[model samples]
Target: MEKYLMKSKAMHYVFVIIGTILMAVSINLVYEPLGMVTGGITGLAIVIKELTGFIIKGGIPLWVTNIILNIPLIICAVYILGKKLLLHTLFATLCLSAALALVPSVNILPEDYLLAAVFGGALGGVGLGMIFVASASTGGTDLLAMLIHRFKPYYSIPRILIVIDGFVVAVGAMVFGISKTLYAIIAVYITTKVSDGILEGLKFAKMAYVISDSYDEIAKAIMEKLERGVTGVYAKGMYSDKDKKMLFCVVSKKEIVDLTELVSEIDPKAFIIVSDVREVMGEGFIEYKQ
Candidate 1:
């Protein structure tokens, strides 16, 4: 058990490092040049740096400001959340702060705000998503969300994040001007969606439930050809007051055609309901988290 925990800790470190690097690169290389200040502690730091052009001999670096703000928030999380979470968040935030300090800012897509927003947001989102899956955050609004969720389970995490980040972005508009602020909004939206896609699994699939008289034959066909598991659920038709076999199956989006055709061929009037499944975890899909 100790060894397993050690391995998990090592993996968490890996996630923190990679995610930190990705975020640092995105922020430095892409967003900074375009002045796309998507809301966060980092974004607030950028605003402050721009506002105070040489207060302490030179303007404060983003990482320095990020750490300055995050310390109190991290302490709050330590008290509110727990030590394990605090450790992960601290590691991730420190790595991110270091990377931002050490890494040079360069403009790969110079003068193209749209391009910067697109790629920068995507890369940042990927980084954020990895950290999220590892059960840690880079502090800032993430930690704030946790603190809020602890007191009010009524408010969802996403809503809390939006409310917090939205306020920052609103303030950012004053610093970055309207044009850059608009681009920043675009970048922030893309970042949220891409990160959600990453954590949820980009390789989307479909979940289907079918009710038909020939469910047995369809199930056998699905199992044999698709090699996907099919569960038989006892279902009753409310309108007709008749009992029927309901087939619950999951398959890749590509297999939907074949499965539907097979069902149609087997039963001409099969009642089928198809729904979107953001993720799947089972014997065939991702293993359940320990």
Candidate 2:
């Protein structure tokens, strides 16, 4: 048991290391060269590095700037987010900083700042996703998001975070240009989307809950037309005080309309409910793996 636990932790650390390095490469190769600040402490670090380049010759390195900014946030996280998260956050931060130092800045794009923004944001998003899935974060504005989440649990941290990151990106607009600013916005949007996709996984499906008097007909129609399995859950109507077959089926979004039509044709007032399912693994969908 102890050996297994150790192995798990080791794998997690490896993943975080890889993720941080990929993120650093994206920053150095894409963001820095294009001067596209897509938000986050890393973005700010780039801005600072450029602004202070005259003072210290080459300027304060991104790794140093990143660590300096993350210090207070890390401390705040330890108090608010707990020690486990803080430990992982610290590891992620350190790994990211080391990566930034090791990975040299290279110009991948010639004149296409748009390409840089897109690629940089996508690569960074993937790295961030891997870190997040491992229960760690590349500390920066992430700490601020967590801090805000702690204060107001009701408000969505990610959405609020967009507003926060917007300011940072706006600063980039001022320093960089209107064109770069637009690309930065695009980068940030794509980054969030790709990160969300990674965190949620790729499995997408729809769930339909149907309560109808002609349960047998509806079930048969769904099986024949939709070619999907239907699970009949025994349920009782509240007002009617009568037992019935509450059918349930998981189908693709494309098939939803067909299934709904079948249900409606059978019984218009069937008390049907449909909902979006983010992930599903079963006989019909992605195979269960362990």
Candidate 3:
């Protein structure tokens, strides 16, 4: 058990390292170069980096700004949230700052903000997703949200994040102009969708509900032909004044067509409703591992 725990921690740190690198790559190569601020501490860093160009030759380096800004936040996080809870987050934040310093700033997409937005968003999303899976964060706006939520329990963390990040984006618009900021918004949206997709799990499936008088026959056909399980839900129809069993089944995306055809064949008048299932676990799906 000790060995397993050690291995898990090791893997988690590895995830944090890799995730920070990817995030740094997106920032330096895409967002920073294009003046597209997607929001967060890094986004604020980019804005500052641009604004300070008048004072400094190339403006303050992103890593410098990132680390300097985070120092106080880290100190507060330790005091407020405690050291134990912040160990992983501190590691992640330092990793991100180090990555920003080490990774070269090369604009791969040059003036093409569209490609920059999409690609940068996807890369950052996947990276952030991996970090989240490891139960860690890069400790920028996320940490700020936690800290705010700590004091004002009424305001949720997510709402705080939106307000904070939105403020950063708005500042970016003023600095970088509307056209680039619009692209930034697109990147933000894509990043959100992709990260959400990663957190929710990639194994997509379909859930189906069938309402028909011949539900028993349909259920039997599904089990035998599709090799899937089915459950009968007790449902009553107010219009028809009838009590019947509604067939509930979950099947892979590929099998949904087969299930639909089988149900239609069994009962042409069957009412079928199909919806997307983001992830499925248990028998014939994602298994639990220690």
Candidate 4:
């Protein structure tokens, strides 16, 4: 058990590092050059960078703004909540700051807003996905969300984050203009979709509910041929007023065709409902892990 925990911790940090690099690259190389602000502390930093460019040469660096902004937030959070709760967040945030500082800025993509938004969002999404999978966050507005939720327990963290990030985006619109802001919104949308895909797409499966008089035979064939398990659910047919066994099974997308065919072959009148499953765990799927 101890060894497993140690390995898990190591893997978590590894994921954080890789995710930080992707996120920083997206910000510095793609979003910064195009003046796209998607939201979060980095977005605010971009706005500040542009504003300060009037006075300071090249304005403030992203890492500088990130560190300065996060420090006070981190200190307040620690003071109000506790250190233990923010340890992982601190680590991830520091890694991101380091990455932003070290990763050289370059125009890797064309100056096209659409292209920048798509690729930037893709990189940020994958980075966020991995960071979330590691059970950590890059702090910034995430920490702000936590603090707000702590004070106002009635409001959820995610809702608070939306409000806060939206405010940031609105402010960014003021700085970057409506056209760039529109592209930023598109980038944000793509980021959300890709991140959600990373989190749930890989584990997606198909679920089927089979109802027929020959449920037993269908279950047997599914288990024997498909090498999958089926559950007999006690169901009552409302129209017929008969107690029947409904077969419940889950299989990969590739195997759903075979499962339906096998059911149709055995019982022509079988009422089968197939649905998409976002995630499945257990035998023949992802193993349960601590």
Q: List model 2 lDDT by residue over 1-290, tens digit each.
A: 11222247777798789889889988999988788888889999989988999999878899999999999889878978899998889999999999999999888886687788788888988887677667678889866876787788775444555677899999998888888889888888877777766666656789999988899999999999889999999988889999888999999888899999989998998888999998777878766554
Model 3 stretches with alpha carbons more than 4 Å out: 1-7, 79-82, 146-163
Clashes of 3: 0
Model 4 residue runs over 4 Å out of place are 1-6, 79-81, 145-163
What would you estimate as the lDDT of candidate 2? 0.84
Between prediction 2 and prediction 4, the one with superior TM-score is 4
Worst 10 residues of 3 by lDDT: 1-10
Give candidate 2 misplaced runs (Cα > 4 Å). 1-7, 151-157, 209-214, 221-229, 232-246, 252-274, 281-290
lDDT of 4 at 207: 98
**Residue 283 lDDT (model 3):** 84
The TM-score values for the models, in the order shown, are: 0.90, 0.80, 0.90, 0.89
Question: How far does residue 32 in candidate 4 sit from its true spot (Å)?
Answer: 0.6
lDDT of 2 at 219: 96
The global Cα lDDT (0 to 1) of model 1 is 0.83
Residue 107's lDDT in candidate 1: 80
Give the per-residue Cα lDDT of candidate 3 at 126. Answer: 78
lDDT tens per residue, model 1, 204-224: 789999999888899999999
Query: Which residue pairs collide in model 2, if any?
Result: none
